[model samples]
Target: MDFDDTPDEAAWRAEVRSFLEQHRGEHADARAWQATLYDAGYVGVAWPVPAGGRGGTPMQQAIVDQEMARLGLPALINLIGIGMCGPTVIVHGSDDQKQRYLKRLLRAEDLWCQLFSEPEAGSDLAGLRTRAVRDADGGWRVSGQKVWTTLAHLADYGILLTRTDPDVPKHRGLTMFVVDMMAPGVTVRPLRQMNGAAHFNEVFFDDVLIPDAERLGEVGEGWRVALTTLMSERLSLGGGGTAIGPKPETVARHVAEHIGALPADRQVLARQQLGRGYVAALGARYTGYRQLSKLSRGELPGPEASAGKLSGTRSARDLADLAVRVLGDDARVAASRDGDSTWQNAQAGLPGIAIAGGSDQVLRNIIGERVLGLPAEPRADKDVPFKESVA
Candidate 1:
């Protein structure tokens, strides 16, 4: 894969850098900065210009993201919209759906959340029990509960996966919909975490009405659409050049500062760990580059994303542990818990990385099945009808 930026890409990078310079230290309103970026054709740079993007390449998009992260700029408010739902809509949505969602999503004027994971269907997402019964008037009544939904309380809409025809096999019965968060019978309650942040929510949908136009794909085609969403999610979550905490370079510096204070044996152990973590971080970064390379060449992501995530999250957790060990318990005070504050937030947040996108175990299954060409896991539920299955 080509690694160096083309002349056009270099020009785009310079333009993005200039825009960033103009907005430095003015990130108080993240949405405003995002709006500015979108207006300047920086947001969704890889998307088609006709589809409210600049039609840039994936490698250029990666470069833009890298520059933004390097500048410590606040992220756009439409994280799920841009990263997951927008890509799905672009691929599988009807023209009207695309027209309604894509531009607003890019500007952060409309936020969205994924309503896929239920209490019982977190990892086994296809086994979800949420039902959307069709009415004679071409709308559907949604009834179910979804847990671990990030930003549901703040979302304007959600991409919901529901069982529309339970008589069929579980996977075949599913359908996806775009539900208005303000619709009647939709409820969202915050779920407080160990970090005391209500980052996710428990949502209850009691006969929420979704018009026929809201359905994302054909009846029984939800699984395919949902796969699109999940694929985008895997790439966004794993290949986004996400750093869980301080860069390993920063950590190495911090560790070096304490090396003189530690005993000889501990110093050796610390140095060894630092070296290993640095190597692992490098591996994860290169893994992301590989994914970008594939995307640049118009190839879809594969199981290697799991490898990136497995290594990246593991490295982040290890670094967080090292930070806590070095900083001691006093750093846990909430008021002092900045990004660099003892890595308390990182320690609390690292577990979600392993669980979110897909669990470490689920990722291993993908790697085993796809990368290694191993035998597929036994699936008793494969042909089971939805109503009769024990899911």
Candidate 2:
């Protein structure tokens, strides 16, 4: 496929650039900036017009992402809402649900988090034990815990996956819901990372009540609904990583600036490592472009999304390691002392990227089974009821 933009795409990119140039500084915060983008029809460029989006092409939305990152603009504060939750809701939500959440989500009026992962059910998400029982009032009462929940502390709402029927098979017993983060019996506690950031949290629910209207999909059909969110998540985490991480040129420049201070022998290895990282970054970028091409065809992200996330996160972690290696002992110094901690934070935080969305091993299995058409792995629990499965 031709990588070059068509004439219309060029015009769209130009329009996006002009808008950013004119108003990049007008917004005081990320929420305000997101609101401005919503008003300008740039927030959800590929969503349906009826869902408060511009109903544009995926390529157009990619252009907006590219231009925003190119200009070093603050990202939309409600990334979870816009990237994963909104898209999933658009595909599976009721009309009223769309009308109630889509516009406010785009405008950053409500922040969202994913309440899918649990301490034991992360990689094997189908094994989640979080329980939600039907109440007498035709609603549900949820009681469970979620770990590694990004933005839970700051979010107003979350897309939650829970076990609604324990008698059925693990994958068949699940349900999805839109939960209010500030509701009674909900608690969020931050989990501080090695980078000193509290972006991840552990959330607990104690009989939290959710109306029937908040159900995302039919009972026992949550696995299907969740796949929609998961696909979008992999795209955002993997495809977007191509544009989000530190570039090879930046690493090369940093090494050049600091190599002389290192041992003469280590300097040669640093140069060699930088070359390898550059090649790997190129591979990840092209892999990401494949996802974009598929999306432009109006297709849902396929297993290739797994490949992108796997390679992209690995590349990011490796590059961060290289950055720290170049910095040597100085890497341990506090950011306040050095007046810069970009590499330090990256080194500390990037390892988790591999684990987030999905682990490297899980992603590889997806690529192997779906892309290569390999034989499936044996799973003893594939047909077992949730309560009968080994805990």
TM-score of each: 0.93, 0.96
The digit string of per-residue lDDT tens for model 2 on 28-116 reads 78788899999998999988999999989888898899898888787789988888999989988999999999999999998999999
Best by lDDT: 2
Candidate 2 lDDT score relative to the true structure: 0.86
Task: Mark the regions of model 1 whose C-alpha exceeds 4 Å error after superposition.
Answer: 1-3, 240-244, 258-265, 296-301, 329-342
Name the runs in model 2 displaced over 4 angstroms: 296-302, 334-338
Reference-based lDDT, each prediction: 0.82, 0.86
Pairs that collide, model 1 = none
Which residue pairs come into collision in candidate 2? Answer: none
Once model 2 is optimally superposed onto the true structure by TM-score, how far is the C-alpha of residue 200 displaced, in angstroms?
A: 0.4
Instruction: Determine the C-alpha RMSD for candidate 1 after optimal superposition of all C-alphas.
Output: 2.2
Model 1: per-residue lDDT, tens digit, 141-188?
999999999899999999999999888888899999999999999999
